[model samples]
Target chain A: MAQNASQLEHFGRALVDLGLINEELVVLDPDVAASTKVTYFAERFPERFIRIGISEQDMIGVAAGLAASGKTPVACGFAMFVACRSWEQISSSVARPELNVKIVGSHSGLSPNADGDSHQTYGDVAVMRVIPDMKVVVPADAPEAVEALGAIVDTPGPAYLRLARGATPVAYTEGCEFTLGRANVMRDGSDASVIANGVMVPIALEAAGSLAREGISVKVVDMHTVKPLDTDAIVKAAAETGAIVTAEEHSVIGGLGSAVAETLVEKRPTPMERVGIMDRFGESSRSYSALMAKMGLTSDAIEEAVRETMRRK
Target chain B: MLRTINKNQVLILTNIPRVPASITSVLRGISRRHKIPLSTLKRNAQILKEFNLIAYGDPPNFSGVELTELGRFISNLTVGEEPTVHGNMVQTRSGFRPLGTVIKDLRKTVLRMIAEAGSGHLGASLSAVDILAILYMIKMKHDPKNPSWKDRDRFVLSKGHAAPALYAVLSEAGYISPDRLMTLREIGSQLQGHPDMEIPGVDASTGSLGQGLSIGVGMALASKMDGSGSRTYVLLGDGELNEGQIWEAALTAAHHGLDNLTAIVDRNGYQLTGRTEEIKAMDPLADKWRSFGWEAMEADGNDPASILDALNACDLTTGKPSVIIAMTTKGKGISFMEGNKYSRKTPDAQELKRALKELT
Candidate 1:
């Protein structure tokens, strides 16, 4: 974690690089180019860029149309608006046809901290996951974000890649192999397991370290791809570690926590606690840290949830 | 699906208000078929005259009411006869037998399919027949043999309820076989209740209103980016204009200066419930489009030659999108269905037979 990096920035750069190599690659934005960091690509390849201007539903439809025309369209916009406002379009136009449109929803969760509740998205992950044939991915850090972009580019059909607005600690080193529908194990412990994704991954890793110093060994798993939840990893974490705690920057209702709980309940039935935003809207905060701390979305929250789950075990 | 608008609401009727002998014959035919009293038929004919649906014409004792130009236009659709046009055929890769003839045939096919499907949108589909026929047969740069050709012009039926018209035109164009028209709205059929791209010649799958414009804008943008001389056309219903997304896409197309995009609105003035003016007054539609930075024009939607003229008048290099506000009757050809309460419903066996006979 020498320098903080943004997953959205990494996504923009990776998409631009992919566009340069892949002639079919095209980017569509809904007036959040600079904020979503898609402006990086827009500046480099002006011809390949389409600025749709503040219409998420229209952007989704356009992207679907482009995909139908044999162009790989990456529709970029804020996570909250793109997922909620145009959920019907995504479902009907893109996913229903199984179009090769990649939806990149930036500023996911509480990342747009100072912008307040309307800007913060706690339900995007849930919304995208439920769409049929939609592949959902939330990268833990910059490197993982780039890898996820590459993976989706190679794959066909509709995929949603969630990216955060603010700078986050770099978790994976360069050349990290990203596999779709697979979890990355950052730490190994038998006492309890902390499964996390997106902005919460580094926090979960820190929580595991803090727990280790207290002689409570903890396992940290990055369940990056949310849709096809890595059942094998979760089952193993429950069977071996005996306890599980799921963390995310999204709402506790239907994001990573819900996905993990659904998997564990049907597979191994382990004691678990979710460390994410409660079922409520976010408010204006001074900073990302303040929002996370206020919402109980910190490493301390993960550690507490881990301890509570371990006690239940 | 039709509900009458306020009878007091003054609408500009396109037909002359006199009853002619031929129209009286049709009314007499209806009276004889339904066993209704001639006095009752005459009273109803007066009501129809109040709406300017028929005009008076004389040949003494044997004279019946005569259908007006508008009435004749609608009646001819039921029997499948092309309206005569002065213009010669405009050449395109897809063969054409004069657009008027093509539209009449397409309208007949649309009505028959609606009757066969047991339930389909009659008014909306018939209203948009000429617009779809002209685009498919003449205006578009499409090849039915190679429906997916990269440079082929695209048409998206944004008002998906009018899918029967698109299916009819697509089938006639050879993108689909005429035999498959019977499978419309059937399970496992490509011809769904709405337009599905799975059906050939349909550029985008659009049933939800206010969405096809955006998809068309997207395709137009793609064509511009690809430097391909392809244009994208989106056919919308006047009722479908109530959806805010249409305006959103409208603004996007204007903002992008997408000259390759054209939106043809079937301004038939009717929605599922009633007159669009009553549901939501979209009067001054051309001005609204003009204010949105589009080159807006109006034409007779049911007339293929007029529609073709308006479409040909569009200048793509002007750096603005074009929209043709086609004024049309809800059910252009069928006398009973035109502006009837059940304009959106399926035609019954008796009505279908009478309609086919009236086409001539």
Candidate 2:
């Protein structure tokens, strides 16, 4: 098994690799290349890297410009700033034009725990998902993040890549297939299903393991792609399991839970519960794990939500 | 009197086939048969009536237009050929037309289009018409026939409300048919109220303010990286400078040393609602750009000669972006409409007629 690594670092490395293959690949940074770990790409391919300073809006605009000129530009910044501060630029300059620009927003959700609510972004996926022609991807681990980056890079259009700051358990092998908009069934069961993305996928697997010991069968799915959502997988899980629990490291309002619920209410109408931030902001905490535990983003929380959903079912 | 008329007007006159035909029926017949927009037919009909080459049915039972004897003679004379004149301006192919003639026709076309569309930025479009005319007709190295040519220069209309001006210039340059200009802001038309990339010759899609310079910077950067040697030009409104992103883009263009990019601020001194200074002071604008590491220059934005000089001067700069703070009247050409109050107002038919007369 590959050693667990920070998704941000993996993304940086994958970007450099992508630059090696795609000559047109360029990187734009809003003064967070080191924190976002795109410094690796900046160092390797200096000409292709644009240091856009502290202006996230300008970074997106410049990225859109580059994309319009036939270059695939990956704009890297903190999730809070890139996804929120420059939302309109992403909408008007990039998404509306359907340009091939990849916006990699690092330090997503509670991953930037010590930075508190100001830096922690729990609504990146929600804001990005709403833009037309914007593909939203939240990879489960470092390996998956690398794969997701490759997929978005290969696909020609606007896309938002949500990445966590800290390292988590590696969820996939080195060469695991990462098809965009297709969910991966991590573990299968019969009673209910736990659909999760980003940092919550591994926790969901752990929760399914605990449920297995209790003989309460549960299915764990890694729904990495938030937009162009795998509605087929969601509907099948809802129909086959009859109950669903959505887990993510974001707000329950417009993140994975809301997405799954929206799909179910329209397609299958299954009983469900959401395990995520309860529409509130994050604050400073001791560590990443402590913040996750404090925010009810763990195996225990997912297990409880799954059981509650099954009881309703 | 061999008055100027475009090929479309010629088509309308010759296609009448008979006198005493209702203007509506003649327009519908020509529109359906030739796939011309009814709006174009209607506007051309009005123009024909104004020139005394056609007469509409009398009021109370007015229905359509009929070509007068003069209209018949002129149409017969110009059959199977381009119109020899377009509103007192000698008509010629896009690249070959004189700058003055192009600017005059573009101004008239812009007013007529806005009047037909019923709503648009008349003042802003008129203010930028000469600048757009100079760029498309003389300065910018672009191919209307091959708009997507990789090595061709690029233009981004950042002040997108001025789309009427850009569309007029584009049609004059042969990027779009003159008839398509009537479809401005109509549903399903390529000529949107704001510039969209779906329109041929529009390099970057822009509408929201202050975003075009960055797009221009990106295109310039890409051109530099690929060694394409293509230049990029962006037209921004002075009022649009209130947007912070424009400054952000300003710093970016200079930081990258993008000498191939040029930004022309159509300094008409007003935005919608009021004069730009009263709304938000942007004095020492040229100094502000120079402080941001750009080669700032000024020109009489509404003058074809001055605009040509400024655009030519941009090519002399090295290792830095260039900006031309083109000073211009808000609603240029027409005497009454040349100010802030007319910023977004579409002209009535009477106002359009007066404006066209001023242009001629």
Candidate 3:
């Protein structure tokens, strides 16, 4: 049986692991080291870690400057702040110059449950995807988060790694090979495909399993890299499956759903449906699961989206 | 004895490799690339040979010229390095002339480039020229030959609209050829309207205001972490202080105790629209920095000696970042254009001539 793991914890541990080998790896936190779990890396590598005391814009500029001076800086903060609050700084300083700055946005989407819409970030993926030379990654699970972290650090230029706050079902075992722009097909089917990322990946897989009992085949793909969308896999899935449904714990406007829809419209024009927050803000809920359910980001919603897309096909 | 080589002669010497190349090919290449006349290239090449920087292949029908040992050394030095002796004058890495002479030349270049481009921030560029000259010439520890030298001090033009000044200083410092200065703001030119990382010797690509000090803080922090002894300097416009990000960075710098970072605010009293005070009252500016825990200082920004004195006065071991509020006139050299409205105005042909005369 697969156990649940925290993506933020895996991300923090991965930074420490990478810091041990790569001397140029420097971690920057905007005063949320404890919440973001970057404290793990900060504890082991105090000299390499810089606590920026809640200034996201300054954190980004500093990251760009460090990158300009030949140090690989990973600036971490909440998605709501680091992605949106400092979007201009990220675009001008880091993306325009193509600096090797890895920006991590923890507590993304509805995962920041009780914090409500103010703390939840549904627009990060959309904003980050729009910047040129910026690679957007949202890992599916804790183990995959570690792998994704290593891959982004190894690759040059600016990258945004989106991490959910709560623990997620482990989708991959340790040492899974994670490529930057390629999508991983979790399960292959013929009737329709469900492409998702972040917390939605596990939910999509569960949806697929449920549909299998109902004599429906659903392909599940973890579309981790959002900016450089895996168009090849998307086209392949659209052609083979004949229909597609996209799921994400973010706004349907510009997250994984839009990325897949744009590709499908241009390349394959397959029948597709997007399962995500429908242009509304989230509210404080009892737990992460309750908030996600209230936002319609569950295995049932993904199943409904797939069945609706199959009907259209 | 080596005579003081003009910009044309320096261009010729640096273009030719240490290995032998035909004089005709060298002349043709330099003429075509820099758009200089073939005759001028020939004269400069001949001067280089006379200076013993280059040697003829043979006495009868000298077919080619190659850099002599001294020629290679001088050429290497021309790429913004140590000084070279030429009669009574010394050619430092900053320029081939004295500091005052180089600054006057830079002001002329800034005006002429803006005039040629037909659009640019004239007053702001002129205001920053002297400070840029002092930094590139006397203050900053940088090597044009190796712009990415790990331990070299970094300078960020946070007030990126003054690119003409930075470009003029860079050309004088040999990071770029002087002829390239004419291509300012032109399509496909490396010297963009704003400072870009593509240009040589540019540490960070900056144009949007209020973002530079944070970058400097990062560089300073990286230097501190590596114990790399390299310093980072950032220049900001006074009007740019309207941005909240500037104060945010100021607090972060002082909080980190980034002693290696020095920020200079070009208090020219004018912004894009109107007077800075009229737009946003930033009085007691130095006090604001002081309150944020920086060691605030003041300087006559247009005066090279004053700027240098203020820069030298910074105590780097105090474990606190410093900010110098350098008070400057918008159009420091050109008299008629010394007003707030000239910030974005390009000098016409007559204005360029008049400005050049004033600079002389």
Candidate 4:
């Protein structure tokens, strides 16, 4: 509602842009200055942002109290600390009450390459998905990041937003319509459905083009909303194409791949292979790309996985 | 102003927010079965007004409701004695037991529950036990029958490692099944090593220290904004005070004049490894709080009578947030563990027995 866009780029900037700011808008996080990118907002509008400082578990409860106090608190923290260290609080404090709190996690899904396993969160989405009332969002790129930020802030319930280390391509045009609970179709092909999100999204699209030239048609779907799991799109793809391959920068188990498989099997069984880090921790000695490659997340690897699953179909 | 209750419904109502169901149906049955004039029933409503079941006044609008720091203290007072929203009490005030008996029972039950579970932060639990006991049995105005009641005061155990005392109080207050107390830390029990709000009577899920106080601040601020006259109480451990976030909350409480917000620093001087002084010194503690603009009090945290009196006396501080630096003995009552530092060594049979003898 403010005239200036700079002031509008506040802690609740995304919500303000979407004209979705409400009385329930509460933003909370621990003391990581640069990671959340909330410092810009804090310096500008200090009242809206609550600095909890290095306490993920406490943030959940505090956010819950704010929620109970009739303000919506968007609780945020680092991916590994929240996804792993503070699950009990997340489960009991925010989710159990089904309080209207948004849990926005920065450094999500192996994006913390500068830091190792302690920081490179592999199972954030998976862990969040297990909690009831948790709607998980893994936005594809920077544009999707902005869009997802707007959508999730106004989503009106307990939710988790998985943000990367700003390691995303600007996928969508400056302003394209986006909402939660739906998947975006980047490419249409009948050969196989290569469902991907976060860092793997651009890679999925590139692989789709490369496979197209090689006479292997791969349909790339951006499965950003991981929890309400986009069953209709995935079911349609599985039933029609008969082959599906899922990729994410997370662990193979209980993540995007696992969520997709869970849907496909319950609706229509499709030949599938999950493309992500096979149950293993990342090492400090490897580059991000090398880690991705070693963990079988390369474009060629995804294309090959797609082709192999199609052959099974 | 204690807003007027529904005059018509007050013919038979209870608890201010609830109506006596049996009376409601009988009145309804008379109107429906006997074809009594509805306007005649309005006469009964007038009778309720005469009986003070409902205050005789013009109805107030929602706009009249507003939150203030003073409103927090207003909600905790005995009826008819309140400075605002004055309500006439229908009955004389009920009496509470002597504070000494209350403290004795609270300590016995809390330590026994933890000792039975075989795994708990004994020192932290004992340190915070008196504060928890005072809040529940004396200071806080809440309905144990309705733990999630919207208008009730909120208490956050920021140092949640001391969940044993919290669980015991919740059980004794009838918010949870007492049988569940023995099942703490069991695979499927709601009682974990730390407090989880999923369990009844817990306001927040907290195990990680220092953060619960911030949550308390948010709750207090929100309550003030919404015009909800509910106070917030947060208990932080002496060791937990080592966290920088605790200072953030402490400073904010006073800067904002969250006078309804009260905190108890459980200064038993022990952390997980040793004395907090050995781990990190946070002395000159009361002076620090006073400088932060809080009217701070130092209490014998082990004395529930002192705790009860000190907490009620908080409102007298005037226009500032209050904190009771509750000086306590770690592992109090348990002779072998009392006045000693923490050891990472898990208590074995001998230690447990010694603790049990003193606690029992």
Error of 2 at A145 (Å): 0.7
Fraction of the reference Cα-Cα interface contacts (below 8 Å) that each candidate reproduces: 0.58, 0.73, 0.78, 0.48
Tens digit of lDDT per residue, candidate 1, span B147-204? 8899888888899888988888888777788889999888899999988778878888
How well does candidate 3 score on lDDT at residue B160? 92
Model 4's alpha-carbon lDDT is 0.70
Candidates sorted by lDDT, descending order? Answer: 3, 2, 1, 4
Arrange candidates by DockQ, descending.
Answer: 3, 2, 1, 4
Better of 3 and 4 by TM-score: 3
- In the range A1-313, model 2's lDDT, one tens digit per residue, is 3356799888889889999999999999999888999999989999998988899998888898888889999998999999989999999999887999999999999988898889989898999988987899999999999999999999989999999997877878776888999999998889999999998888888888888999999999999999999999999998889999999999999888899989998988999999999988889986989988988888999888888988898
lDDT of 3 by residue, B1-360 (tens): 334878888777666632235788777877876799999888878888878888876457776676665775565455333232111122345323556777788889998899999998889998998789877765666667778888888999999999999999888877888888999999999989999999998988999888998899899998998898678899999998998888989999999899888999999999899988899999989999999999999999988767766776663347899988999999888889997757887778888888899978
> Local distance difference test, per candidate?
0.81, 0.86, 0.86, 0.70
Best by the DockQ measure:
3
> By DockQ thresholds, what CAPRI class is model 4?
acceptable
Candidate 4, A1-313: lDDT as tens digits: 1111111122234543433446456566587755676665566545666766566665666677788666777776788886677786677666766778888777776666757778888888889999986899987766677777777766777888887774455556545566798999988988898999887888898888899998988888899999888899998888767899998999999999998988888888889998998999876534767767766878888988988998898
lDDT value for candidate 1?
0.81
Candidate 2 lDDT score at position A48: 91
Which portion of correct inter-chain contacts appears in model 2?
Answer: 0.73
